[model samples]
Target: MVRKPDFKILYVDDEPKSLRYFKKTFSSDFIIVTADSGAEALDILSDAGNNIGILIADQRMPEMTGVEVIQKARSFAPEIVSLLITAYMDLDVALDAINGGHIFQFICKPWSTDSLKIMLLEAAQEYERNRHCLILEQKNRELEESRRTQERFIYTLSHEVRTPVGLSLNYSDALLESTLSEEQREYATSINVVNQSLLSVLDNTLDYSMWESGKLVLHEFPFKLSDLLERIEQAFGLQFKTANVNFVLKRSTEGIDNLVGDPDCLFQVLVNLLSNAIKYSAAGKEIELSIEILKSSDRSVDLRFAVTDTGEGIAKAIMDRLFKPFSQLQTAREGSGLGLLISKELVTMMGGEIGVNSEQGKGSEFWFEVEFWLGSDSSDGEEPLNGSRTVEGIPILLAEDSAVGQAMVDGLLSPGIQRGDR
Candidate 1:
């Protein structure tokens, strides 16, 4: 069934007989309102509010010419499709009207009924097309502005949150270094966990804004998959103590070595999946980070990484919002909610895809697929990074603008390493 259009046609002429003939001819196929004079037509257009889609006016009206009426009608209905009717041959006037864009077309004294119908319908379609195009352009502008506003809010909020979060982490680190009772140590551990989560959220917001603005930076380096998993395991190994969750890295048995990719970005995406799993799981529950080799070639290998947890599964109602920022499920534990969003973005940047599968009563498995170029571990003449590298008495200059960044560098550096001003 065809949906009827909601707009109406407006015909203006000084002759009452012409008005009655136009209504009798086209009233069955179109909704129309008639005006006997240009002044009356302007009043109808001004009061019609958007109901008028087309206007057919007589050129030989005593008060005003058709071109004059159409030109002035624009003040009320700028996009109205217009056609002029004339009883005499006036090619110069017709050319001026068409060239000036005051009228869509001119009809001779005796117009064929069939030809006039076709022209009127075509003008209606043209009006519809132009209206839709203008609406689309306006919507696009609004969407762009909304995205800019969101980015600005994220940036402002991230900076405002940075100072307090950094102070909290610095304090927690100091407290952890000192000897403490079991309860005090547990309290410090909890604080550190929250601090790490905040840092992760801040990092994600910044990364997302950067990605949206086309300023995200990525690095490619050579490293073994096993080594990267081991590092993540070690980092999470300490954090898992707070919840007493069993965190395991189920590495693939394939001979995956010397992979070249953005390790930091991949690491962050994996950490997001794993941390989310940890958030939803209970104490004593096990969470597995597994990898599988999908396809391998001479220079590149495709792989799938998954983090599965035996926690209460997700509800279907919130699944659509799973990867949107600040849409964390209402669970026993709190989360930043930006992890999965940024994870999806990072995975895409790494030429990968990410998703999750779950049943309400069972558990959830969040997964991502990525491809990496195969290369030697060493680049240039420098030795490959390893666990035992030493930098005794080596002076390194630091130039970081973030307080948490400077503190992280400070903590990661060895005791023998010296830091100097650049």
Candidate 2:
């Protein structure tokens, strides 16, 4: 298993014994980096550029107090979890640090080893939670941008569909007049064929929404992935023949035949990828599909699949928005721009992730990884999907600096709790 990124903690104090003691207590779980004073701690952080998951600093030092150090650390690394360890009861300074530096906890000095360890672990977990929230916020921003792009796409799709419909209507009207020449009648028939093709594209645009809303249910059963691939090939064979696009499909393992999944939804993802590959692919170029299994953790597996095309590759500037809904590579032409978005949503619904890699003029590869369950009871089976698990029951440690809020939380958590007068 790839080790979860180390949770780094920085402890700053004047006493070497205290630092050593704290290190000995939590060294196994946390990467504990220590300094004799606040200035030394700042030097260490600046030099190493430590991605400090948590910071624990002593209240009084020769140069600066724990609160001052945390306040300064906030400017350099605003996201690091901070804790203030103080021997003195300076309520005003502690409150200022909590508000200004966004400190996670305030630990009183002469602390118990057990309590301190538990507190640090809780802070680390909260740090990870915040990190995930930040990632989701970024994705949401990209989604917004994609929505704006789709607005333009809707206009473009409307224009593309309307032009053919208008032409077909005029040609049919002319044909019905009963005064058209033979050449004009032949032209009208051609217009009808073109209109049908345009309608097919429009149908694809509508199909995108179906897959997105989970309205398009998949047939779930045991089936060889290869059979599905063949079905895809048969379905898209005519498009390849018409476009003159070369196709290549490869599988890494032979024994990996059958999979327990919704093959129909999987087919839709493949079709969307393959369609994009062919549509954007340079005429007479090759498109390829490959599949393999990757171990994401000690007891989990992910099926990685990729579709590569030799076509106008995506630009780097827009790579960040590739998975975003309704994003087109470039708007030089017209499109609904929702193919990749719906494809991502479909894969995600099946406990998977989707991403893309592209280079200008060098073509692009769209890939997704789905949690894989082996046919046999392998040690590493499938795991729950991202964001699927909820915290059913866990202790919450709120380290609010406000006395009133702290009292309220304690009262709610335990009705009989009482605190001594200040």
Candidate 3:
């Protein structure tokens, strides 16, 4: 069933015959009000308090012209759109209606049913647009206020907390190096590490806030996935080893090894996923990393990526908000809860996506998929995919604006050309 429109319109004319005809024509579309004179129309509007959406007036009335009638109508309902009816001979009156009464539009007398219907619909659309724009401007002003509040909070947090924590970490480091017993030295080292961890959490918190505020910056460049994966493994190797977690790597597409992208963002994504997996998994469980080619239905192009994990499976409900920032679910007890959120944001900024799948008792698998350019260098390099043939010597372009990105891109595309600032 169609929903009935909720607007009420008031149509005024000094001719009773014309008024009756309008009542018959527009009774279904609007609440039609008729009057034999402008004075009677004003009396009706004044009595009803003008909650009207549209005011339609006939031009050649005696006591008052259509422009005069609508001009008075504005005082009753400032929000209502006024329209005037005029014949060709009353062109001057139509202009007068627009200038003196702020008429939204005018219709020629003897308007066709179709034309009238179109005019009313256009007026309704205009009303909705103006209403929404006003609402948007109001919302924007509130958002600006909220941003100011957040900036003040960050200022206080940085000054009031970070400085003292920094000094404590420095003193703890000094104490670790001094002439002390082995146990004391170990305790000092532990204190230093804990302090550093706390500091890192605080920093990540600030970064997360910046990201939430849409202020995070990304520097994209060419980087080797193999090299990036190696660096990540090296950093997390000790943690996995201590936990007795087995780490496995399987490559399927070597074409992406020397691909163009942001290495730091990619590394951060992998690190966050791997770190979380290690944190939540049972000791001695296996953490697998594997890449494969993904072909779209069209079969003309493909993408590549890896999934790594060794953790108790994520619950269905927990998995739903896994990527939401500051959303720490039962399945996520790894870092400050900002790691995956930041990682996901970084991956998206670099034109990639991260996803996860898991059963309740089985371990979860976190994966990242990125668009890879097929290269043609099968003879020289070992393929990331064991069985698939590698494309050779694909000409890849690297672009960057920052020094760090330039260096990263230069390193990734060793034998390829590098470009800056398109």
- Strongest candidate by lDDT: 1
Measured against the true structure, the TM-scores of the candidates, in listed sequence, are 0.62, 0.41, 0.48
> Model 1: clashing residue pairs?
none
Candidate 2 lDDT over 256-324, as tens digits, reads 755767877688788778877877887889999998877544433577899999887877888787667
Give residue 119's error in model 2 in angstroms.
Answer: 53
**Scored by Cα lDDT, where does model 1 land?**
0.82
Worst 10 residues of 3 by lDDT: 413-422
Candidate 2: regions farther than 4 A off: 1-219, 296-301, 375-422
At residue 274, candidate 3 shows an lDDT of: 70
lDDT value, residue 99 of candidate 1: 96
Decide which is better by lDDT, 1 or 2.
1
| Candidate 2 lDDT score relative to the true structure | 0.72
lDDT of each candidate versus the true structure = 0.82, 0.72, 0.70
Each prediction's RMSD over C-alphas, in Å, is 8.2, 25.0, 13.4
Q: After superposition, how far is residue 174 of candidate 3 from its true place, in Å?
A: 11
